[model samples]
Target: MADGGAPTEGRGSVAAAERGATAIADRVVAKIAARAAREALDGVPEGGAPPRATVTVHHDVARVRVSLELDYPSDIGGQCGAVRHRVAERVEALAGMDVPEVAVQVERLHSVHSRRAAQGRIR
Candidate 1:
């Protein structure tokens, strides 16, 4: 005679224990991508908060589009590359998702001289 009980170890036991799967939200992915983009700023001043990012996830694949305001005269290509790589890595590591593409848009550019001029006006 044998008792009907769940097995302690085995593929069947693992599968049986996982009664349901976990689902990740789009907003959660967007936030993580945005933070990853910020980490690519390198030496630039990130002001106060991370830049905005729009992310669309489908069937476990995430497509991210990030908007950034980078410093003027910097290595634009290098920065964008960094953002793309960082966002993909973050999404995979943190969200456990696959990011096939990361589109980066430089919406604005802030110049050091311009910032100094604006600050000088305040005083």
Candidate 2:
């Protein structure tokens, strides 16, 4: 060992292949995907739950599924697209894994009209 405790070169140092690899857990990747989706959406809608994600990683490839609720009267397709793009980009950048697919599921839509109706504010 060197003064700094690091392995000294040519002093019985093992090859890179001998060292094991670092693996990022599936839950960590899922959290990353969820956060990325939130970032893409700017935040969760009022009376709506934040995005939740599930990820499967295999051989450095990640497949993700994100479920979220959004405000009604908005661009649903565009929002989903943004989430997919951001998730894929972030997971690849942070986890160093290939994101082959991101499936976005819109769990619910919060609408002002529905709330008003439920509150007896509308005819």
Superposition TM-score, candidate 2 onto the true structure: 0.84
- Per-residue alpha-carbon lDDT of model 2 for 1-123, expressed as tens digits? 878787876899876778789999999999999999999995788778999999999999999999999888889999999999999999999999999899999999999678778889645
Residues 1-123, model 1: lDDT tens digits: 125665556534565546777789999999999889988786445453357899999988999999888887789899999999999999999989999999999888878788788889995
Q: What lDDT score belongs to each candidate, Candidate 1 first?
A: 0.85, 0.94
Residue-level error in angstroms, candidate 1, position 84: 0.3
Q: Which runs of model 1 end up more than 4 angstroms from their true locations?
A: 1-18, 43-49
- Residue 69, candidate 1: C-alpha displacement in angstroms: 0.4
Candidate 1: clashing pairs of residues: none
TM-score of each: 0.79, 0.84
